[model samples]
Target: MIDFQPISPLQRTWLLELGLERAFLARLPQAQPGGQSAPVAAPAQEAAAAMQTAQPVERHLNDAGSPSPSAPAAATDAMSARDQALAVLRKSGARPVAAAPVEEVVQRPAVLIQPEKAQDMASLLEQVQACQECGLHTGRAQVVFGSELLSEPDWMIIGEAPGTSDDRSAKPFDGKAGLLLQAMLNSAIPNASVYKTHLVKCRPLGNRPPTQEELAACRAFLDAQIRLVQPRRLLAVGHLAAVALSGRDEDLETLRGQALTYTDAQGRSLPLVVTYHPASLLLRPQHKANAWRDLSLLRELQNQP
Candidate 1:
């Protein structure tokens, strides 16, 4: 018969120094005080147990904590390569070896267009047409500026970028998706008017994902639109739009129906809401329930006195 022993104070202290808790040290035979048998855990079993125990901490430490459903394979490959390099160095008996710093590479500089400060919409349109700060500018067929009434609007909707139809039309939110977005707004605000725009001006090649650079380069234009509209409420659609506006990569699931605040050009705090993109909803109809909830929250906010 085997009996388990309690952990030693010295070993518990060592494990604690390594960022592990005394409870975890107590599970390991090496840390256990002498005189009793301990149940040996297989390496895989030990790893599984550790993972289960540390899951919450791991989530907090991760940048987004949740996997992006739309993350590209190339990005995953890059991450794997980095992990492999670190592993090889560690296994090579390299003394004092440290993991490389994960530098967030920005593909391009962001632009800030404060349309409220602009002389007129025509001039803002001209500026958007000529802007070329990212590689997407070269690949685009046309630029999608934005659409809004000449008069002031109560609501403003922002999306990630131009799709095939939008790229060809140079209009933000055209086609079935546009129709759906309009319907959603009309349902919520009955008599209220809503403005629409994209984060990036140009359409990415082959409808490929917009890189960080492309989003950054066009940030100014979106910012400018917000300043000009000064809408009572702003709705950021899509993961990219949410991240661009919030300055954080939070999952749409967690962000939906939640109210956030963004600083406008005048540094005024603007109320913000996040929702699934019309395009995404078209792809995954199941998310429409959540979208409806978000839209309902937006309606409630707008109706608030």
Candidate 2:
């Protein structure tokens, strides 16, 4: 039997806005003539079908980065993630306005490990474990690199930085947050292979935020991991991970629930989305509605080839 947890009124509103209310209220399984259970209702099936067939919505911009006449009008809450992203872009004066500032803040470090130096994920792991790029490394109990890389992961989950449990376990996304993350991911994309990592490898002292210099220091390692894993999509949880991965320091509200892109050193691009961290969600249950919307966006991306 499928267990259906009761959802909040806010969550109901979110589902209604996204046309997913039926999916949540999908009929329970019933026994068939041969004692076999009937297939799950079309509500869930249709949702999955929509996810599988939904093409990314695109909008063209003029020379000044303003939306062309061909661009779609303002997207409402009901619009798809891609549509919402395009809408957000349109409102922000699109890329032409924001490009220069973004580029200015996102500069490469003076020195980083070359691809030739860390050829594969294994070699990169060794180098990362020995990383001493920033002061965070000095007070760290262990460098929480990440889980083992999936040769071809469907999703690459990036978190802000290591927490207390992570530092002790020498793993990224540990304890309650990790469990919640896993549950959420599984709910969205069951059996889909995922690789988890953090923006910064080592934990900061007393849980203070890592400095900008520290994030820059370990940028190469993160980039290398992305290159090696080559995941189809990236889900950056929390403001710091979103900032580090997207190369944009916009507010989390401006960043989340939108279809973004992340480009690696090799120029390979992947679909990216930012959402509230699971830890944050734990503290503020109200935000799970927003996170669910982000997950729906992620599910849409995963459906595409």
Candidate 3:
């Protein structure tokens, strides 16, 4: 079963005003011929379905960035993992967002990835929405340029890619996982505003892992964000996130709780830590303690001379 991140009461109301989300939009066309309320849900489904059927995908990476035989380990149990992840969140003081209906999401015409020059964040975001660097853009609703860039942030959090709700809201890390992250960040580092974004801006149909070609195409864009943001530390969640950010293909579980470093194209060395994806935390919530250890180490690094 697909799990949507709970949103705040206010956000739920806003989503409602936006015009019925997935479930409501699914029944749109049957209502009226000329007046199907929103275009976001329909086009996404159409284009995504077409892509899913038409292209011969590298199934090894289905649902997470993987070329491994087991895609994010499919044999894992869904029911118990979700329950454990929820318990971890509740213990961490997560503020759950109640469910509400919503309308259209941000949608735009396809554009090409801008030439690789140092453009400001706003300019880069506009260009990314149009970027067609890889096939992932085929069914994209919008580019999650990431949360606002701070002048100089200490931590830059990254995940594999946007999920369904993130695609609709045009916000990275904006689901149940996001609420869990917020709870962790707030309690751990109250004064810091960590910039978060995804390795792939577009959502792969059914939230599968991105293919190698997709990762290669988007690498330049992420590299650009890292350089521009110049974050002091990197918080990479999940195997794919760690691989892309660290440029090391170590098993995610193996790399967890270790001090990892990423060297940018410009030769700047940034400290990074790998941990289970927030979604995975929902899957294997016992790993939350391990993630907490990683976070503690990040703080230690931040205070280092």
Candidate 4:
């Protein structure tokens, strides 16, 4: 037997919203002559018929013209299903189905590899001479693969990117800023060789700031260098280097005079000392005092056996 319960005012209101009450009542399954199940029309066919009528459901009123609970169980169920179908259609309106046109997927080419710290730097440099990993590689006069100390250096210096001079010479930090960096390194670790590198191998256009996309592309190379060198302490000079090492964008002041720790690929925490970029001190001579304090702290950490 069909479950015929009295409809609630809420159900009647909802059925009226779907414009399905009349059509649903018309298509409800009727009892067969024999004691067999009545066949019902497919939901899709009923939905199409309701769409064709497109007329709003008429409201039932009492003698005082107030809404009444007269909608049947079959009507309520059909209305609920129609509402659910409408909701699904509306939600998927923005997505493409099988009927939608397909577009071709264009894959980007892989970047050229330049293994500067591998067994041989010259062979690796030759390989990356025609690199096109990113747009910067195309614009650069020469790729600054970076330099490493021949000796077992206790400290490593990581900089932001190749400046104009570094790009010209195919070396890192060859400009005036590089000179200041060398001086700072000499004072901090006199006997220790200062290996220099740019976070990005290629020079950016007009020495403009490196975009986040470019940094992401070059991060793996920097990480590789850190692993190869295995320095006791790392000196991150400049905002980009500091952020790369610390995984945060804390201010230079908060970063200075404090020893921060970074986890290496082997799950080992490496000691990192933050300091003002040589370029910064050159521009703001007044902050030299703060830089000296940071340098002092780095020396103390290095001396720790």
lDDT of each: 0.68, 0.72, 0.68, 0.67
Q: Which stretches of candidate 3 lie over 4 Å from their true place?
A: 1-115
Cα lDDT for residue 108, candidate 3: 66
What tens-digit string does per-residue lDDT give for candidate 4 at 1-305?
Answer: 22223334455445556564455534434434454434344244444444433223223435764334785554545454444434433444422122234588998666457554444445455545545666888888888877854444677788888889988898888989989878876797677656778788899988886888898877766776666666777888888888889887888777768889888877878788878888788899998888888888878887888
What's model 3's overall lDDT? 0.68
Off by over 4 Å in 1: 1-117
Residue clash pairs of candidate 1: 110-216, 111-220, 112-220, 113-220, 113-224
Better of 2 and 4 by TM-score: 2
lDDT of 4: 0.67
Question: Judged by lDDT relative to the true structure, which candidate is superior, 1 or 3?
Answer: 3
**Quick one: how many clashes does candidate 1 have?**
5
The collision pairs in model 2 are: none
Candidates ranked, most accurate by TM-score first: 3, 2, 1, 4
lDDT of 1 by residue, 48-153 (tens): 3333333322222337644455654433333332233233334543433233566998786444444445666676766677676778878888778887454667
TM-score of each: 0.60, 0.61, 0.62, 0.59
Would you list the rank order by lDDT, best first?
Answer: 2, 3, 1, 4
Question: Candidate 1 — what's its lDDT?
Answer: 0.68
Per-residue lDDT tens digits for candidate 2, residues 167-243, read 99987889999999989988988868999998888999988777889888888888878887889889999999998
